[model samples]
Target: MPERKILAIIQARMGSTRLPGKILADIGGKPMLCRVVERARRAACLDGVLVATTTRAEDDAVEWLCRERGYVCTRGHPTDVLDRYYQAARQAAADVVVRLTADCPMIDPAVIDQVVGAFLAADPPVDFAANRLPDDRTFPIGLDTEVCTFAALARAWSEAGEPYQREHVMPYLYEAPGRFRIFLVRSARDHSHLRWTVDTAEDLELARRIYAHFGGRDDFTWGEVLALVEREPSLAAINAHVQQRTLGDQA
Candidate 1:
């Protein structure tokens, strides 16, 4: 059999309700979406990275940025993200798929490779793999990574009917444990306390501080950010009070 193509698809949009256009928001003089794309491309395990956005007129800016930056992009359903991921994977001819979000400007490429490695190493060959499974999350919120086979993605796309499952894109696979084998790769230490995602103004402030510390570079490792937070405990306090929306919460 030919080598499996591992594709990383970063889903982005300008219609965030918590922080409108958060994906286009600036961090270290670069858009958040660009930062995510740049970092994800550095993963040694990924064959390619694509920015998947919606066909909505508001997302035109996302497509424009991808074009200007010479990154591959695919357009799909604005709300039904399962369909979007399935279509993106199919179009890219991906045998293995990595799912990422533009809000995670601090996503670590090494962690991405780690998750992919775990997925590939599963004895029974899990249908889905992620650094932080829904219930047992250990990695920081922004460093979230999910890997799955194209067949699993297609299965979720066709079988999932709930709005949340369709919108969140992989809940179905893990939700029904008996149907799909799932694997969760956890960090040595629990860092779920850290919130680096750009979901609100305070979250953005924390991310900006991190980017500023790295001199606006996207190559910094997630460990470096952890150390920075360790030195300055106040940084994590910025969004400590911010409540993350539950899985059932609608867009």
Candidate 2:
């Protein structure tokens, strides 16, 4: 039998609805994509990290940056992100694929490990597992991580017909009850109210402020960030009003 390999594919593009070209937005002094990739690579569970971007002309910059930084990358359909992920995973021969987004600059490596550990250790073997999904998300939005066997991903790629399912990826596995066994990694407390993802102008500002608080350090733990927010409620309040768009809204 072949040794299992887990690959983290950080989906990125220059076309964010609220903030176009935000993938390269500077946080502290580094590009936000670099920060996300750096943090994700720290997770011991991931055998490799690949940046999945689109082939559109505008996204050429994304591919170029990956080359310059020596981060492995694969390109595919722009709107059909499920295809992008599927192709990327197939090229890497990834046995297991962990889905991440470039918008989450504050993504934690510990959380990635915890989620990957659960998926790896599942006795019955879940088809999918994620830190946050369709609903009841306890972890902050930025820490979102989705893990699925490449088989499950391949199935979704072939059968998922809805645009949202194709664009968001992994929804087909979890949206219908009992379609795929799923493991959800929830927080001990309800920190779901927090918004750490950089989806809008305010979100980018908060990310910049948080990184600045750590003096441009990229290795700060989520606990340290929580403590920082606790001490400075104003910081958490930066993008507190920013409403997260639902999959329905996104479609």
Candidate 3:
């Protein structure tokens, strides 16, 4: 609606070191990737949402799921995810690209709109904007959203040399301060300690519990989930000990 085509490209696959086949994992009554797409579609900022899987044989199921649901999906290198994003953006003719991961089934549409709105509202416009980053992050883990221009994404895809940069996607945009115009969107309340992402067994357990609490409804906002976790402290305790993984640790 802003004259530019905004597409949220979700990088997904059947392989995950921590939780293999997690894209298709059940969180509530539906597959987690489907849940992510459904929630993303609710965001008013996005023109469309596309899933970018890999060419690996294992990811055929991912393509199948996308097809069965009538979602547009693109296949690319398994590890070079930056390339996958660039190709997906180019193919979709996306002027603005929002990057999301499939592991986050509870991704908030409000949060997506918030970040995308900020990205679009920037006076001079930033090369990239994100709700969470390495040093400054106040939002919960699973609600993370990163928005960048297709040109910015293409630059990163062409220039990023580090494997971690490629695998994590968007690191090249923010890893260097002056190299690209970067903006940070922080929440008023610091909820960085909250781990809502599904990357481990504990994280998955917590996701199922949260979804179950909402009666398998994907319309719940991040605020409601925060309140639910506050009222029921036991729910937060479920994954309190699970440390959020960092690219530095793996790199």
Candidate 4:
């Protein structure tokens, strides 16, 4: 058998319905997308990192940023994120793919490594892996991780044709539990309540508050975010109801 190559592909775009150009928005000193890519690099299991972005003209700036930073970039259809991922993975020649979203600047590298490790540590075989697909887990939103074989991805690409499936991608694999072996990462509910994802002005304010609490530090972990949220409960109250409450439903 051939050795599996793990690739982390971050999906980003210049247009965000809730927070326009949020990826390029400044968090601390650097753009939020750059922060996310840098954090994804810290995952010990990821063999490579690529930013999968949209082909829209607005995304040209994202491409420029990638080139300037010496990071690999791939562009594909904006709406069909599943297709974008498939194209990016094909270009990167990845055997195993990890999905990350650019809106998550405060993502924890430790959590990324743990989820990746769990997939690799699975008994016989792990066809797919994610930290918070079912949503019962208390992990922070920005701290999501997914590991899937190229074969499985190809299967999803060919078989998962629903609009929601194409938009979010990989939902079918998780719904059909018996089809793929999935590894879930469940740690204490430390940062689970922390609003790290940026979707609206409130979410942006929440992220800014987190950076302020941590003094604009990029090395901060979800544990640190949790500690701060515990100390200042008001900060955690920011946009607490933003993430869909239905996300709590798990299989």
Candidate 3 — which residues are off by over 4 angstroms?
A: 248-251
TM-score of each: 0.98, 0.98, 0.97, 0.92
- Candidate 2 vs. true structure, TM-score: 0.98
Task: In angstroms, give how far residue 27 of model 2 lies from its true place.
Answer: 0.7
Ranking by lDDT: 2, 1, 3, 4
lDDT pick, better of 1 and 2 = 2
Candidate 1 residue spans exceeding 4 A from truth: none
Backbone clashes in candidate 3 total 0
> What global local distance difference test value does model 3 have?
0.91
In candidate 4 the C-alpha lDDT for residue 150 amounts to: 84
Give every collision pair in model 3. none
Worst-scoring 10-residue span by lDDT in model 2 = 242-251
Q: List pairs with backbone clashes in candidate 4.
A: none
lDDT of each residue in 1-251, candidate 4, tens digit only? 67789998999898876678999988777888888999888878889999988999999999999999999999999888899999889888899888888988887788878888888788887888888865555787677777788888888988986777777767867877587777777766544666678877777787877877667778888778877878888876888878543321210
Residue 171 of model 3, lDDT score: 92
For every model in order, what is the number of clashing pairs?
0, 0, 0, 0
What lDDT is obtained when candidate 1 is compared to the true structure?
0.92
Candidates' lDDT values, in order?
A: 0.92, 0.93, 0.91, 0.81
* Candidate 2, 47-143: lDDT as tens digits: 9999999999999999999999999988999999999999999999999999999999999999999999999888888999998876678988789
Best by lDDT: 2
Per-residue CA lDDT of model 3 for 1-251, tens digit only, reads 46999999999988788889887989898999999999999999999999999999999999999999999999999888898999889988999999999989889999999999999899888889999889889999999999999999999988999989999888999988799998899999999999999888899999999999899999999999999999999999999998888884431
| Winner by TM-score between candidate 3 and candidate 2 | 2
